[model samples]
Target chain A: MTYCVGLLLDAGMVLLSDTRTNAGLDNIATYRKMFTFEDAGERVITVLTAGSLSVTQTTIARLREAIEDDDATGETSIMLAPTMLKVAEIIGNTLASVREDIDHKMNATKVSVSASMIVAGQRAGGAMRMFLVYPEGNFIEATEDTPFLQIGEHKYGKPILDRVVKPSTSIEDAQKAVLLSMDSTLRSNLSVGMPLDLAVIERDACRVSSRRRIEAKDPDFARMSEAWSNALREGFSQIEL
Target chain B: MTYCVGLLLDAGMVLLSDTRTNAGLDNIATYRKMFTFEDAGERVITVLTAGSLSVTQTTIARLREAIEDDDATGETSIMLAPTMLKVAEIIGNTLASVREDIDHKMNATKVSVSASMIVAGQRAGGAMRMFLVYPEGNFIEATEDTPFLQIGEHKYGKPILDRVVKPSTSIEDAQKAVLLSMDSTLRSNLSVGMPLDLAVIERDACRVSSRRRIEAKDPDFARMSEAWSNALREGFSQIEL
Candidate 1:
């Protein structure tokens, strides 16, 4: 299980991903799902993944292998892709192939080897873009009307985003919104855990602007969670029947 | 689809259910998911159901038929059952039989004829109780540690309930909590809709003390939803990053 969200706002893009993976209660592990590729001042791409660990890990590994290849081209490398849309296409194709390979090996066991990802980034002199890439190699970009995309255990954290997010939201508020969204998810679901990977890519910067890894005991996160809880209780009490 | 919540609080029990049924996006119809039976001052039993409408409707009909039979006995009827636990048992067995009957008839289509229900209420001289009865004729009761049970499209509405609901919450507060919970679900899911049926059973009263049906344009409901949305935005703005 995983919980990952990407916000495409006027100010920038914010991406957050939890690092918990479990096959069962006894087989839980921490595995980072957020991957960042940057050619500072040229392009920055961040991918947040969910679903089968094997598929996502292999897809990321292959994408990296392609990036490091001497003959890496726009056809084989996300970094070399000419546009954000093409970056999504490259990632989606890689994910689809990895999933197919795994499915062929595990098909007789009635298992599904599907994974999904959120691709958020910008290329030099281009617009910032965000997409939800599906297991079938198709993708949907976030729009002004619906400016956020989430995958894996998304419902528990969605109501808040629905209420607070908008295209004009600031980068600071966008960061807070995603954190609170993740807080709600963590409290409600056992499979989604910390430390969280948070990245902010300012519009047109073409580079990672800020990044943080929030652990369970991170003081700022702890304070924010406590303050949000208190605020909710106070707000709930104030609402008249 | 449906969204029904049952809260077992120190003050009493609160049950709310939405009334939307759909075979697909276009085949939607309104069917009451809440059924209440009360021998005023003696006993009250409310059943809130979700999932296979055929199974749930059939189970409720059978339970009613047994109650109306001249030969209805302690073994065949919920009202005559000595304890709330016994009442749950009777309801569970009835639901299981109904589901099994339907499953047999629909076996060739590979469809699941299963349903889930929350049974909530009290009988004179008995403690108030709530149980989530499964399609297999088994059930689990709400406890002090977790005083609420929800079925069908529950995740969207669960975070607030997790944050605010406790066994010691006041009945008025409990009512508000559940309405807000349902409001969240209705906003996030099209399958769960208005109007909603709400019933409250006060501790030791052994009968429904209050009930209301909240339509889409119900003034109180509209006001509450508006207030809640405002409160949430205010809270979000006040939280520090």
Candidate 2:
């Protein structure tokens, strides 16, 4: 299981993903779920995935191969896609095909092989856009009314996002919003774990302006988590019953 | 869907439940989910239910009928049960049998007819007890380490309880904890709604010490919700990004 969030803000996009992957309580491991592709000022794309590890990993691998293939046409690679929508299309198609292939082989055991992803970034002349791509190759763009897309273990982290996130939120505030959102998730759920990967893409920059890998013992993250906890306790005490 | 939470604290117990019921989004209605039986200083018992409304309603009706029956035995009536555990056992058995009867009738459509309950109270000379009774008649007691039990739309309301609740928590704080817990669930999930039923039992009192039915326009509830939201936003702003 994992918890990944992508915010579409006025100033930029903020993407964050937890590193925990677990088949069971005893079968848990750390796996980075954020993938980045950039052609400097031309285009920049970040894909945050959640679901079956095999399908997401394979789909990402296939997308990379296509991007690096000399014979690959514009339709075959997210980097060369004409718009953010096209980028989502290419990734969605790849994920759907990979899922189908795996699902067909796993049908005997009645297992599911499906994954979903959040695609966020910008192209040179195109508007910055973000989408939540589903398991069946369908996707929906993040609108001003709902300026964030989340996948996996989302509910526990949703209340804060519902209250705070807006299209007008600044990149700095958006970053804080996502980290705090992730903090709520990490505290409430055992399936999501430490060593988070966070990426910030300044609007129109077409490249990741800042990236941080937060480990279990990172002072900043620990401080944020502690501060949030203390604040909640204090707030709880102050509320009149 | 519904949301009901019960806390076992040193001061006694706190129980809160939502009143929303739905067969589909188009068929939503309000129905109370908390029932209480008390003999003042002799004994007190409260049942918080969730899941199939039909099963829970029928089970409660049957439990009431038995209590009024001329041949009612100690084992058949919650009011006459020897201890809180026995009361939970009687409720569990009644719930399980009722579910099986309904399930047998609903087998053709394959609609589930199962419900769960939280039994909380204290017998005159016995210790305060809380049990999460499952559909199958088996139940688990809330331990000191995990002093809270929730059913239906639980995850959205769980993180706060996980962070703030303990066996030593005061009954006043416990009531606020469950109400705020319900508020989180209400904000995140459309399936759970108001008005809410809250009850508190003081240790050895053998009766509900306090009870409140919070409506949509209740001033106190409104103030609490607003205070909580403001506190959360203030807390968010205070945290360093």
Candidate 3:
């Protein structure tokens, strides 16, 4: 299980993901679920994955392989795609194919291996875009009305996002919103643990503007989480029945 | 789909359930999901249901029938049960049987018909208790450590309960918490909607102390929901990144 959220805001896009992966309760492990590809100034793409490790890892590896392939074309490599939409298509196709291959092999054993991803990026001279790619190769783009997309263990963290996020939200505030949302998820669910990966892409920058790896004991995150909890409790105490 | 939550506090128990019943997005109707049986002053048992309407309705019908039966005894009728635990078992068994009956009929079509219930009550000489009855006839009681139980479309409303609910929480605060929790669920999900049933039982009262059918246009509920949203947004704005 995993938790990943990406927000497309007026300032830019903010993405965050937890690193906990587990086959079962006793088989938990830490694995980075955020991947970035940059041709620095040409285009920048970040993919945050959730679901079966085998499917996500294989899909990512195939994507990286395509980027390095001598014969790679716009349709074959996300890095070479002309637009953010094309990049999403390439990633979605790769994810779907990898999932199908794995699901086919696991069919007899009745195991299910499916994965989804949040693709956020900006290409030079193109609009910044964010997409949630489905396991079946379909995808949906973030629009002004709904500026955020989340995948896996999402419900626990959703109410905060639904309340606080907006198209006009600042990049700084967006970061705070996603973190607080993740904080709620972390507190409510054991499956989504810490050592979170956070990435910010400023509009028109075509590269990740800033990034942070928030470990389990990151003091700033800890303080913010505690502060938010205190604030909520205080607010709850003040509400009239 | 439905949403029902039961909270056990030092003062007593708080239960809330939405009335929306939907077979599909296009087919929705209003139906009460909360039922109460009281031999007032002797015992009071409240059943909040979620899942297949057929199963829940039938289970309640059977429980009602047995309570009115001339031959009903401690082994069959919940009103005659010796303790709150026995009352839970009677309800659980009836629910399980009803679900199995419905499931068997729907088996060929593979249209699953499973249901679950939250039974909270107290007998004249017994302790106050709350049990979450599963579809399999097994049930788990709410303890001091975790004094809340939720069924159906639960995730959206869970974080607030996780933050505010406690065995020591006041009945007034408990009502506020469950209503706010339900507010979140209503905002995040369409399947769980208006005209909620709220019941309160004060400790050792052996009857429902107070109850309210909160309609969609209920001014007090609407005001509280609005206040909560505003408070959350204001709190969110003050948070630091």
Candidate 4:
């Protein structure tokens, strides 16, 4: 279980993922769910995955192998893809392939192997784009009508996004929205835990613009946590009889 | 799908439930999920159901029949039960029986006919209590440490509960908490919609104390919704970069 969120705003894209992974309640471990590929001035791709650890790890490995392949073509590697759509296509293909391979083996044991990802980035001449890739390999782009995509333990954090997030949200605000959303998820769900990876891709920067790994004791997150509790208490007190 | 919540507080017990049901997304309809059984000055019980509508509807129908039976006895009727625990036990056992019956009949079609309930109220000479009943006819009480119970679509509304809710919370505040919780769920899940039924059982009052049905065009809820959106907008704007 995990909580991963990606926001595509007019300012840019914000991606956040939790590091906790659990096999049953007792076997909890930290595993980064985010993968980023950058070709400096050429292209920048960020992927935040949530689901079967085996499938996600394997799919990411295959994508990296393709990126490092000297004869890599657009269809073979997300790094060299001409457009964000093609990049999503490559990722979807790899994920679906990995999921199917694992699903078949897991079926015998009465288990499911499923994974999904939020893919966001830009190519040299292409637009800044974002997509939510499903377990079955289909993808949908974020539009102005709904500028954010969330996966894994989404319900706990969805309300804030619904109330305040929009396509025109500034990058700074978008980052806060995603972090608060993640905070809500972390509090409600034991499956999704701390040590968060946050990355922001400023519009047209074409590379990872800002990155931070927030450990459990990070001061800013601590402030936000306290602030949120205070705000909720104040709001509750202010409600009338 | 449906969303229902119940709170037990010193001021009272507050129960809120949505009225949307869908077999599939295409087959959506409105059906009340909150059922109240009361015998003035003796006992009162409100059951909020979630999961298979078939199971819940039938279970409630039977419970109502027993309450209305001319030869009603403590063994056969909720109204005749001496304590709220007995009432909850009766409801839980009835729900399990109905679910098992329906599940067997629907086996070939592979539809789950299971349901859960949040039961909250007080009986004369008995303290106010709240219980979350599982499909297996077992239940867990909500203590002072955790004074609320939610059934169906609970996640979207959980953050507020984790931060701001407590046993001493006034009924007015409890109402707002449940509404805010429901508002979040409504925004995130298409499967859950309104009008909503809200009930509050004041401690020692022993009867259905206060009940209101909030329709789509309800002015109070509409105002609260607008205020929340504005508050979120203001909150986001005030956060410094």
Alpha-carbon RMSD, each predicted model: 1.0, 1.3, 0.7, 1.5
**Fraction of native contacts under 8 Å reproduced by each candidate:** 0.68, 0.69, 0.66, 0.52
Name the candidate, 1 or 2, with the larger TM-score value.
1
Runs with alpha carbons beyond 4 Å of true place in candidate 3: none
lDDT of 4 by residue, A1-241 (tens): 9999999988889999999998899999999999999987678999999998999999999999998999999889887787788889999988999999999999889899899999999988888899999998989988899999988888898888887788888888888888989888989888998899999998888999999999999999988877766766665566543
Write the residue-wise lDDT of candidate 1 on A114-161 in tens digits: 899999999998899999999988999999999999999999999999
Pairs that collide, model 1: none
| Model 3, position A169: C-alpha lDDT score | 92
Candidate 1 vs candidate 3, DockQ winner: 1
What order do candidates take by lDDT, descending? 1, 3, 2, 4
The positional error of residue A83 in candidate 1, measured at the CA in angstroms, is: 1.3
**Candidate 3's residue-wise lDDT over B83-149, tens digit each?**
8888989998999888888889999998888899999999988889999999998999999999999
Relative to the real complex, the DockQ score for model 1 comes to 0.82
Per-residue lDDT over B57-134 for candidate 4, one digit per residue giving the tens place of the 0 to 100 score:
999999999888999998889878877788889988999999899999999998667799998878889999899999
- Model 2 CAPRI rating: medium
Binned by DockQ into CAPRI classes (incorrect, acceptable, medium, high), candidate 4 is medium
Worst 10 residues of 3 chain B by lDDT: B232-241
TM-score of each: 0.98, 0.97, 0.99, 0.97
Per DockQ, the best of the predicted structures is 1
**Per-residue error (Å), model 2, residue A28:** 0.6
What is the C-alpha local distance difference test score of each model? 0.94, 0.92, 0.93, 0.88
